[model samples]
Target: MMWPLSICVLSFTFLMILALSLVSMGFYFVMNDLVYFIEWEVLSLNSGNIVMTFLFDWMSLIFMGFVLFISSLVIFYSDEYMAGDLNINRFIILVLMFVLSMMFLIISPNLISILLGWDGLGLVSYLLVIYYQNVKSFNAGMLTALSNRIGDVALLMAIAWMLNFGSWNYIFYLDCASHSFEMTMIGALVVLAAMTKSAQIPFSSWLPAAMAAPTPVSALVHSSTLVTAGVYLLIRFNALLVGSYHGSILLLFAGLTMFMAGLGANFEFDLKKIIALSTLSQLGLMMSILAMGFPKLAFFHLLTHALFKALLFMCAGAIIHNMKDSQDIRFMGGLVKHMPLTSLCFNLSNLALCGAPFLAGFYSKDLILEIVSLSYMNYFSFMLYFVSTGLTVCYSLRLVYYAMSGEFNTFSLHPLNDEGWIMLRGMLPLAFMAVMGGCMLSWVLFPTPDMICLPLYLKTLALSVSILGGWLGYELSQGRLSFNLWVLRNQFLTSFFGSMWFLPFLSTYGVSFGPLNLGGSVMKSFDHGWSELVGAQGLYNFFMLNSKITQSWQNSELKTYLISFILWIIIIMCLVVF
Candidate 1:
C-alpha cells in the first residue's frame, strides 16, 4: 500500500524539485505567451498542419502545478480510502494515467494532440467510475462516458474545422477568429465542447452521477482536472469567444448552471452529492465570470476553488469512510467528537468554500463577485451570480450543522479514530493550501482587477446573501423551522431539486431513449423481419428450390437412359444432315 502511494509521492517530489525552474519560465513567459512547436507532425493535411506544440505561460504553469498538487493529494488519500481493496494497484495506475492525460491537455496548443488528452480523460474516467463493479457504478459510468462523448465529438469537429485555418494550432488564430464566421463556428463548437466538459446546464447531470467513482477520483475529476478542463479550454480560447454571440450564449448557460446547482445543493441530502452539486455551481461561476470578459479572474477563482474543493472532498471522503460508507448527512451527526481533526478540516474547507474572509476562496470568490458587480450586465445575470454565491453558503452551513454539530447518530461506537490518520495526512498539504492558496496565488496572478465603482448596497450584495444563506441554513439544520422552499419539506421543490430540475432526465433518456428504441425497432422490423424475409431467407429458399429441381431431373432407370441416348443420337444425325 505504501509502495503504491510512493508513485504519486515521487511524481510530486520531482515536480516540486522542478517547480522553481518552471516558475521562472512562467514569469518570463508571462510577458510572452510562449508557444513551442516540435517538428514531429503526426499527420499531413493540406489545410491544417498537425504538429506537436506546447504553450507555456503563467496560466499553464500555475494550472498544471495546481493539478499535479491536487492529484498527489488525491492519490495519497486513496491509499487510505481504498485500503484492503484487491485492485489497489490498478486504482493507483488509473489515477496516474488520469494525471498524465491532464498534463497532456495542459501542454498542447494543437487541437489534434489535445484530442489525445481529451479522449483519454473520457475513457479512463469511465473505467474509474465503474471501479466498484456494481450496477450503480456501471450506470454512472455510462452517463459519464456518453455525456463526455459529446465534448469529445465536438473537439473532433473543431479539429476538422481548424483545417480551414491551415494550422491545427489554435493559439495563432485566436484574434483572427474573433471576426471571421468560419472561425466563429470553431468558437461555437468549442463552447459546446466546453459546456459538456464543464457540466453546464443541459450537460450537468453527469457530474453528480460521477460520484459513483471512488472519493479520491471525485476529488480529482470534479474539483480540478476533468470538469475544469472545459473552463481551461475556454480560457485558452476566451479572446476569440468574447464580445460575440457565442460568449453571450456561454454566459447564459453558465448563469443557469451556477444558479441551478446552487439551488440543487441546498436541497440535496447526500453528503457527496451536495459537494458534487457545489462543484457544478462553482464551475458555473467560473464560466460566467469568464464570459464577463475576465479570463484571468476566472482562472484565479478556478485555482483557488480547486485548492479548497479538493480538501473539501477529501474531508467528505474521510467522514464517509469512517462512518461505515454511509453518505447521508441526515444519518450523520456530531462527528467532531469522534474525529476532531477531520472535523476541523471539514469545517475550514467549508468556510473557505463559502468565501469566508481571508480564507483561500475569499480571495478569488470576492474578486469574481466584485468584477461581476461592476460589469454592465442584465439584472438576471447579476442576480444569478449573487444568488448562487449565497446558496453556496447555505449548503456549506447546512453541511456543518447536520454533519458536524449534532449528537452522534451511530448505533455502535466504532472508534473511527486514528485509522483516519492516514487520510488526514493526505489532507494536511491541501488544508494548508486551501487556507492560504488564494492569498498566495492572488499576489502571483494580480493584485486587483480594474472595475467601476458601485453603490454601497450593490457592493455588499454578496455578503448579504452569505449571511442570509447562513441564517436560513442554521434554522433548517437545527430543525427549528423548515426552509420548505428547497430542502426537506416541499414535495414539488424537493422533487425538482432531487431530479436536478429534470435536466438529468432530459439529457440521459431524452437524448438516448429515442435513438435506442428506434434501433430496437430496426432490429425487430428490418434486421430480424424484412431483411430475413427478402435477403437471407429468400436467397436460401431460391437456391434450395433450384437444387431440388436439378435433383428431380436426374433419372436412374436403364430404359430412361436408353431412350435419352437414342434421342441424343437422332438429334445429332438431324443436325449433321441439316
Candidate 2:
C-alpha cells in the first residue's frame, strides 16, 4: 500500500522538477535571443519600454529551491500524518494546487502574471484552511480570505498606478522614484498589503485565528509559504525600496509588530498559538532587516526561520496528536521521559529560536541584530530590537519549560511514546537541518565584507543578554519573581498587551476625530442629511409606497397591449421616415 503511494508522490515530484527545468531553459533561450525578441514586439502607446528582461535570476532560484524543498517535506510529512483520513485525496489535490500556484508566483514575468498567480495562491489557501469544514475552520478561512483580499486590492491599485504612469514593466517601475508622490503612495499600499499578508503588527489577529486548521497546514502556511509571501514581495521590489521614506515606515511598523507580538506570546497559553506568535515576531524581524536595505539578511533569516519553526510546529503537532487534541501547555509537562527523541528535537529547535550560538537561528538572527545596531542607531529601532530580542528569548524558553521541563501534573492515560516511524522520519531531517544549516553560510546571500565580524565585547554582550532573558523567562513562568518592579506585568498592562487588534482600529479611525464616531455623531449627521432627501426609511421604501398608487391607475392587460401597439407604430413611422 505504501509503495503505491510513494510511487505516485515521486512521479508527481519528478514532473514538477521537469517543468521547472524547462522553464529555466526557456528563460535562457529568451535571454540569448534578446535582440530579436525586442525587435519582434508590438509597441503600445500606453506601455513603458521594457528596460530589463525577465529571467531566472540568482535570487529567484534560491527562493524557488526553498519553496520546492519545504513543500516536498510538507507533502512527505502529510502522507504519514494524514493517512487513513477520508479526505486525503482532496488534501493531495489542494497541496498540488498550492505548490503549482507558488511556482507560478515565483516565475511570474510581469505584473499581470504575478497578480494571476497571487489570486490563485490566495484561493488555494482559502480552500486548505477550510478543509476541515467546521465552524472554527470556516471562520479562519474567511479571515484569511478577507485579509488576503485587502492586500490583493492594494497590489491591484499599485499596478493601476504604474500603468497610468507608464511604468508597468518591473524594471520601469523600479526607476519610478522620480515621481515621488506616485511612488510613495504605491509603496505605502504595498507595505500595507505585505503587513496584512505576513501577519505583521496590527494586521496579526487573523494568523492566530488560523490555528483552527490542521497542524500540518499551520506548519506549512506559517513556516514556509503564506506568511513569507510578504517578504518575497518586498524582495521583488527591493529596487523601489532603496532611498524611499517608506523604508523607514517599514522599520517602524516591523519593530512595533515584533515587540507587540513578543509580548502577546509571553501571555499566550496555547502551544500552537505561541508558535504562531513566534512566527509573527520572526517576520517582523525580517521586515525590519529589509527596511534597513539588507535584503540578504532578511532572506537568510527567512531560511533559518523556516527550518526551525517548521520543526517546532511539527513537534508540537506530534505532542498534540499523542495527547488527543489537547493544545494547552498548562496541561502538558514532563513527557521528555517517555518521548525522549521528540523532546530532544523540540528542545533543539527552541534553542535555535532563542538564538543559541552556532544554531541556524543564532547566525541569521545575530546578523540581523548586527545590521540594525550598526546602521540604525536611532532610539526607536534600537529599543524595539532590544525589547523584541529579550521577549523572543522569553517565549522560546517558555515553550521549552512548559512542554518539556515542568512537573508532570497529568498522568499518561495512554502510553506516552514517540509517534510512528514515518512521522519521525519526516521530522528528523528538519531537526538535522536546524542544527547544521548555519554551516552553509557561504551559500546564503549577504552583504560584501562577506563575513560579518562582531567585536568580542558585542558577542559576549549578546550572549549574556540571551542567557539573562532565558533565566528571566523561566523565573517568570514559575511565578518565582516578584511583580512589584515590573510595570508591564500589571493587570491593565497585560490586558492592553493582549488586545493588539485595537491598534489597527486606532490607526484607522482614532486620528480622524469626529469621523471615528461610528454610531454617535457621524450616524446622527448621516441620518439628518439623508432623511431630508427620501425620508428615514430611504429611497427603496419611498418607491414601494408610491408604487401602490401608480399601479392602481394601470389597466394591466390593456396597458400592456396599448404599449406594444404604440411601440410598433413608432418603429414603423421611423422606418418610413428614413
Candidate 3:
C-alpha cells in the first residue's frame, strides 16, 4: 500500500522538479541562442555512421518541460482515477514509460534515435490502450498499434534513405536537403510518417477508437504526448519540408482532416469519443498550420492546446468517475449544479478550445487563422479552414449543452459531485494554464509579435464564425434547428458525418477485408490442400507403402532363398554337361 502511494508521489515530485528546471534551462538557452549536441558513436559502416545523439535547444527543452509538467499532473490525477484497479502499479509504470519515451523523442534529432523513441512510443501505447483487458480495448489497441505501425515503417524507410547521406544525423543536412531530389524524397517519407502519427486524413480513425483506454491515459496521450509526436517531428523538419510540393500535399490532407474531425465531433454522442475527436481536430490544426510553413505558430498552438485539452479530459474523467462510469452525454445533464468546480473547468476548457478571447487557445489558434487568411491559398483550402473552425466551436458548445446544462438526466440516486480533491488538484493547474498559457507562450516563443495587415472583415471573420458556430451549436443541441429536419430525413448524411465518412470502417474492415480473405484462401489452397497432399502427407504415404512392400519381401525371404538355390544347382549341372 505504502509503495503504491509513494510511487505516485515520488513520480509527481520528481517530474515537477524536472519540469521547472527544464523550463528555466529552456529560457536560458533561448536568451543565449544556444544549442548543445551530445553524440556517442555506436557503429561505423562504409557510408553511414550509427550514433546516439541528444540535442538541447530552446524548442526541445521547452517542449520537454511542458510534457513533464502535464505528465506529473496526470500521474497525480491517476492516483485517484485508477485507485481501485488491481494493476495500479503497472498502469503508473506504463505512464512513466510513456513520458520517458516522449522525452527521448523530444531531444533526439537523429533518425536512428528518433526511431528508437518512435517504436518505444508505439509499443507502450498499444500496451496502455489494451490495459482494460476487454475485447473492445483489444480491438482499439490493435487499430491504434497497426495504424502507428504505418508510421513506424515510414520512419524505417526514412532511416534507410538517410543511409545514402552517410549519416542518420539529419540536422546537418536540412540546409542542403532542399537542393536534392533524394532528400526531398526523405522529406516526403517523413511527412507520411507524421501524417499517420498525428492521425491525419485516412489515418484519422484510430484516435477516436483509442478512447477505449482509461481517461487518464486519454488525457495524457491525447494532449501532450502520443498524438503530438508527429507534429513535433514536422516542426523539427519544417525547414526541409516547407516550400516543397510535399507541403502542398500535406496542406490538402491536413485540411480535410480538420474538416472531417470537426464535423464528426458534432455528431458524436459518446463523451470520450467527442473529446477524442476534438483532439483529432486540434491535431489537424497543428498539422495543417505546420504544412502551411508556420512551424512556430503550430508549435505555439500545440503547447496551448495541450494544456487545455488535458484539463478538459481530466474534468470529463471526474464527471465519468462520479457518474458510475457512464460516458454517454445524453445521460449527463445539470452536472454544473452538481460538480460546480468540474463544470467550471470543463466550460473554461471548452471556451479555450473555441478560441474565445484572451484564452490560451485564442492566442495561437486565432493567430493561425489570421495567418491563414493573409497567406495565399486555394479556395478549397480556405473554405476548409474557416468551416472547420466554425465546426470546432459548434461541437464544443454542443458538448457543453448536452453534458452540462438542462435537466439532470442521470439516475436519481447518483452521487455526482466534485469531491475528489486530488482530481481537482490535477485539473486546477491545467485550467489556469488553459486560461493564460497562450499569452505566456506567445511572449516566450516570439520576441517580436507577428504583424497582421488584414482588412477589418477578414480580421473579425474568426470571431464572427465562432459566435455563429456557438449559436448553431446551442440550437442544434436543443433540437430546434430546421436543419434537424434535413438531418432526420437524410439519415445517410447524418451517418456519413457521424461515422467520420466511414473512415473507421475503411481503416479497419475495408483495409483488412481483402487481405483476410486472401489469407483464408491461401491457407485452404496451400496448407490444407495441395501442400498437404504433395508435401508431408504424400511423402508419409509413399514411405509407408514402400516399407510394406519391403516387409513382405523380408517375410518371404526364406522361401525365396530355397527356390534360388535349386535353380542355381540345375543351371550349374546343365553348363557342365554342355
Candidate 4:
C-alpha cells in the first residue's frame, strides 16, 4: 500500500505538470492550428516516408489535456479504491499505459504512425480489461480484444488503400479526397473501425462485458479515452465525411446505438453496467450528432460526457468497494443514508447525464437536440433521437430509485460509513467540473451557434422528453413492476432489451462461425485432396505414362504399326464428327 500510494502521488504530480503544459498549448492552438513534422527518411524506397508528424490543433490539445487531467485524478482516486489489491502496481502501470496510448493516438497525423498508438491502445486495454484473472474477466477481455481487432484490421486495410495516394498523411488529403472513390472507401472503413472501438450498435457488446475489469480502468478507459477514439477520428476527418453516404449511414447506426443502450440501461440492474450503458448512450449521441454535421458539438459532448461519466463511475467504484463487492442495485437501497457524499456525487452525475439544465451534460446535449431539430432529417432519425433522449432520463431515474432513495436492502448489522476522505477528495474536483465544465467550455470551444429565430416548442422538446421520462420512471418502477401484465405478456421485448438486443452474440459467433466452417472445408478439399492429387506427382505421372505409350507405338513392329494406324484412324474420325 505504501509503495503503490507513493507511486500514485508521484504520477499525479507529473501528470498535473503535463496538463499545465497542454493548457498553454491549447490556448496557443486556438488562434491557429499547427502541424509539425520531424522528417528524415528512415528507408531508401521512394514511398517509405516514415516521418513522425503531429497535428496540434485545438482539438488534440484540448482532448489530450482533458485526458491527462482525468487520468491523474483517476490515479489519485485509485489510491484508495485499489489500495487493498496485491497487484496494485500492475494496475497503475496498465492505467498509465492506457493514457499514453490515448495520447499517442490523439497527436499522430499519419495513418501508419497512428497505428502505433491504435494498436498500443488495443493491447493495453486488453491487459487492463482482464486484470482480475477470473473466468468472466478472461472472457470479457477476449471479446474486447477481438472486437477491437476488427477495427485494427480495418485500419490496416485503409492504410494499404491509402498507400496508393503516395503518402499516409491523411490529414493533408481530407479536403482533396472529398469524393475520391478510394478515399470514400477509406472513409467507410474508418467509420467501421471507429464503431468497433467506440462500441456502436452491433459491436457494442464488449463494452458492458468489459466491466468485468476493475472499476478504475472502467472509469478511465470507457468514460474518457478509449471509447471516444472513434468520435475523435471522425472529428479529425470531418472534411471527408460531410455530405457522404457513409455519414448518413453513420447517423442511422449511431441513433440505434444510442436508443438501444438507453433501452438496455432501463432494464439493467448491475450498477457498473448501468453506468456502462449510459456511456454507450452518450457515445451514440455524439456519433449521431457528428453524422448530422456537427463534429464540434460531438467533440464538445465527448469531453463533457467524460467529466461526469468518470465521476459517475468513480462513485460506483467507491460504493461497490465499500459494499464488499456487491453491485446489484436491488440490494442497495437507502445508500444516501450511509454514504451521503458518494451518493451526492452519484446523483449529480446522474442528473447531468439526464441533461438537467446548466450541468456539463446539458450544454452539449441541449445543443445537439437543437441542431438536430434544425436539420432536415427523416422520421426515423427524429424518433430515434427524441425517444432515446427520454430513455436516458428514464433509466437514470430508475437507477436513482433502486440504488439511493428507499429502505436499506443490505444487512442491518453492516457498518455503512462513508469509506474515508481519500475517496471523497478525488471525487470533489470532478463533481465541480461535472457541474460547470459545460458552461465554461461552451464559451471557449465554440461560438454560441445562432438560434434566436427558433420556435419555443422546438427548443424545449428535449427537456419535455426528459421530464416525461422521469415521471414515467418514478411512477412505473415503484409499484407492481413484475406483476404488470403488459410487461409479463411482452416478455420477449423485455428480454430483448435486457440482453442488449443480443449484440454480443452477433458480434462474436454470428461473425465468426460461418467463416470458420468455410475455412475448414477449403483446407480439406484443397490442401489434402485436390491440390495433392493434381500437383507435382500427378502431372509427372501423366507425362511419363504418355511418353511410354508413344515409345511403344514407335517400336517398328507389325503389331505396333497396326495399333498406331487404328488409333490414328479413330482420332481422325472423332475430330471430323465433333
Best by lDDT: 3
Candidate 1: tens digits of C-alpha lDDT, residues 1-578: 36644655565466555555555666566656564455566688886655677776677876777787788778767766887787877888898899889888988888977888888899999999999899999999999999989899898999988898988889889886678877888989999999998999889999999999999999999877999999999999998767889899999999999889988887788999999999999999999888878898898889888988999999998988878898999888878887889888889999999999999999889878877777789999988888888888988999898998868777765756645766888899888988888888877677454555889997888889999999877877776533543345568767787678998888768867888888998899999998998999989999999888656546456776677679889999999999
**Which tens-of-lDDT digit does each residue in 134-223 have in candidate 2?**
988897788778778888998898888777566455645656464478777777777777888897766777788778877877877887
lDDT of 3 by residue, 1-578 (tens): 67455688889999999998999999899889999999887899997766789999999999999999999999999988998997888999999999999999999989888987899999999999999999999999999999999999999998998898887888899887666876898899999999999999889999999988899999999999999999999999998767899999999999899999999999988999999999988898898889888898899999999999999999999999999999999999989999999999999999999999999999999999999999989999998999999999999999999988888896789898788999999999999999888888888889898789999999999999999899889888998758788898999989999999999999988877878888989999999999999999999999999999767767786877687669889999999999
lDDT of each: 0.84, 0.75, 0.91, 0.87
TM-score of each: 0.91, 0.81, 0.93, 0.89
State the lDDT of candidate 4 residue by residue for 1-578, as single tens digits: 56544878888889978976886788677756554444545655664444667777778888888899889989988888888887777888888989988888998888987888889989988898888889999989999999999999999999999987988889888887779899999999899999998999779999999999888889998677889888898888777678999899889999999999999998888999989998998899999888878888898899899999999999998888888899999999899999999999999999999999999999989888888888899999999999999999999999999989888898988767786677788889899999999998887787545653468898788989999999888876786656477678999998898889988878667767878778888988987668877987688889999999888778768998898889899999999999
lDDT of 2 at 471: 82
Candidate 4: segments with Cα more than 4 A from true spot: 3-5, 31-49, 447-449, 481-483, 511-513, 520-578
Off by over 4 Å in 2: 1-3, 6-54, 165-167, 175-180, 443-457, 481-489, 499-578
In model 1, the number of clashes is: 0
Q: Residue 202 error for model 3, in Å?
A: 0.8
After superposition on all C-alphas, the RMSD of every candidate to the true structure, in Å, is: 4.2, 7.1, 4.6, 5.6
Point out the higher-scoring one by TM-score: 1 or 4. Answer: 1
For candidate 2, the per-residue lDDT at 488 reads 49
Pairs in clash, predicted candidate 2: none
Q: RMSD of model 3, in Å?
A: 4.6
In model 1, state the lDDT of residue 415: 51
